[model samples]
Target: MGIIQSLKRFFSKQTETSEKNHDQALQSHYYKMTKDKTFRELENFFSEKEGFEIRSVSEEHGEMIVKRTKGKPAFIVVTIIMVRPFRTSVDFSVASETMLFTDFGSSRRLIYGLYEELNQRLTFVGTGLGDELAK
Candidate 1:
């Protein structure tokens, strides 16, 4: 990582996973699982982790809002969308609640960590598929 990139990351309070993210770790990840199953797994995973609390869930929209109340507080939004049968994409938006200018990449780290966990539990698929799988 270049110094400019590092500085930008350090000063940024939020990070979101997307299909074309320059940072590979921040790219949207695809999994071979049903949306419902993925949602359940995510809820259970967060519930099992200490200091993390699920604030709300919208099954209709396939979205979950989570809050980290313990050390280094953060707000997280998890989105799961099914592009095809048994092909789902998971994206994360995380924002660190720090009192200073930046969170020092805490949000990025949190998203990366969450993706790592999901990758371990779910069937792996390629990242940043976008519409390539549709056509």
Candidate 2:
């Protein structure tokens, strides 16, 4: 009985360690994705293209907030959020002051393409996220 209990405890410890490692990997991946210079440039490019000035960008939290002035009495604020998990895939969302947009395929593709372009310009150090946006 004691031997069986010891085995159970060992397995439980191993499972916990595995989970922790997976979490760390996810965090590292997220950090790499956010810290990529290409990604940063793309974010700025998008903000400018949309005529919104970026207010702040939180790479650790994977959030970007931008503000735009749309004439008198109308103001638009946009937020870009990313969710990445090691065990799963990366996800992205875009929201405006008034509405939540769920269509990500096109947006993701655009981002990925921009990253690719930057990578080419920079000699392709790799984004560590190949084809992730395509999926």
* TM, every model: 0.92, 0.30
Worst 10 residues of 2 by lDDT: 13-22
What TM-score would you give candidate 2 relative to the actual structure? 0.30
Model 1 alpha-carbon miss at residue 97, Å: 0.5
- State which candidate has the highest TM-score: 1
Clashing pairs in 1: none
The residue pairs that clash in candidate 2, if any, are none
lDDT of 1: 0.91
Alpha-carbon lDDT, every model: 0.91, 0.36
Highest lDDT: which candidate? 1
Give the distance in Å from residue 6's predicted Cα in candidate 1 to where it truly belongs: 4.6
